[model samples]
Target: MVEIIDVDAENVDKYGFFCMRSKPNSDGYQKKLNWVKERLKEGLKIKIIQENGRQKGFIEYIPGEFTWRAINAKEYMVIHCFWIVGKGQGRGFGSQLLNGCIDEAKQLGLSGVALVTSEQGWLPNKKFFERKGFKMVDKIDEFELMALSFNENSKPQFYDWNESAKEYKEGITVFKSDQCPYIQDAVRNIIEASKDLSISVQIVDMDSYDVAQKKSPTPFGVFTVIYNGEIITYHPETKNRFIKMINKKNLLTNS
Candidate 1:
């Protein structure tokens, strides 16, 4: 039988968060661990599925008010990350992990469970939630805000971004947080690439979940690259790809 383990301060150091197991000693790991520690005090919850002493999956969540996504999720439970890897896929582990979140939301007396999904990127697909009875409440760009509401009258909403993107008028701006272990390296790569291409770059490290929810130019709210006040991508790309994107944007602007 696979066992689900809730990560806490006592055991967090012993197990990886299911993404950065290889680089446990890296700066990204330390940063993400610290971030998780802080969020725990604010009601963050993480559960890992262990099968035969190996971690196969994990889910991260928090009270809706502390979710990193730019949405009005107050009185709801927000899922931040959910993943089932390798042999864990297609074995009902996904449903188990999701159900764990749903059960917790019910216990907390929240309005419901909410999560952000995308057709691409690091987020989960919408089909999984839809199959579990989540409804599409809102959408921004390519992202969808889905919710399983216990209250029929309550409708959560996505944050306004049209004006937020305008905050940075020029230059390549990266809005990021330590929520993901990979973002530290991605941020470094962008900085190096900017130097090579002689482009001005701004890196905004969202130190708190509130900052991310309020200031992120994109709804994904974890890592977003904005070029000349327009979003380029929400996920990290190779250094070469980053350079090419900047060059292409420059060409179009200069043309």
Candidate 2:
């Protein structure tokens, strides 16, 4: 039998946030764990799927006003992450979880549901959400802003990423938030790569939704790497990849 469980601050210790299950003791996991605790009070919701008795997949969503993404979705429910691992694919689990989110939006009288999709990184694809009735309202390079509106007149849109990028016009800046447990390692990798190049690095802590919505260099607001004010990456990569990306972009201190 399949089961869906709701995870809250009270039961989070029991159910976990789902991404860092294998490294609960790591800094990334601990950061995410604490972040989840604080976000729960701000109306974040997570649901996990279980097949028979084993955990298989999970989804996380939050009120648009408090979403970490660089989108204006004040009255919508913004989906942050969705994943189905291993044997969970090829089944109806994905649909089950998505429909539940939609249903909850209706129940709460939200304007609609919104999410950011991309062809790169760990985000869900636009095809799946498009098939489920989400419309592509905006586009920025490889990323797409999608929304399913309950009211036609009200919809969500992404912020001006180019304008936001102007704020970090010099040096290497790495922006990170506890929303994703994996970002801790990415930040570390960037620092290490910068060290190899003899370049100084500035790490920005996106500790609140306001900072993210206003200053995030990409649609994926949680993690970003800005090199001389241009966005080089919206997700994490290895130290070598960072080195190569910077070298290709510009001749820094050493490269």
Find the candidate with the highest lDDT and give its number: 2
How much is the lDDT of residue 105 in candidate 1?
92
TM-score top scorer: 1
With a 3 Å backbone cut-off (N, CA, C), the pairs that clash in candidate 1 are: none
Per-model lDDT: 0.88, 0.90
Candidate 1, residue 160: lDDT: 87
- CA lDDT for candidate 1: 0.88
- lDDT by residue (150-231, candidate 1, tens digit) is 9988877898875777778778899999999889888988988999988899999888778888888887788999888888
> Would you list the clashing residue pairs of candidate 2?
none
- After superposition, the stretches of candidate 2 with alpha carbons farther than 4 Å from their true spots are 251-255
The ten-residue window of minimal lDDT in model 2 covers 161-170
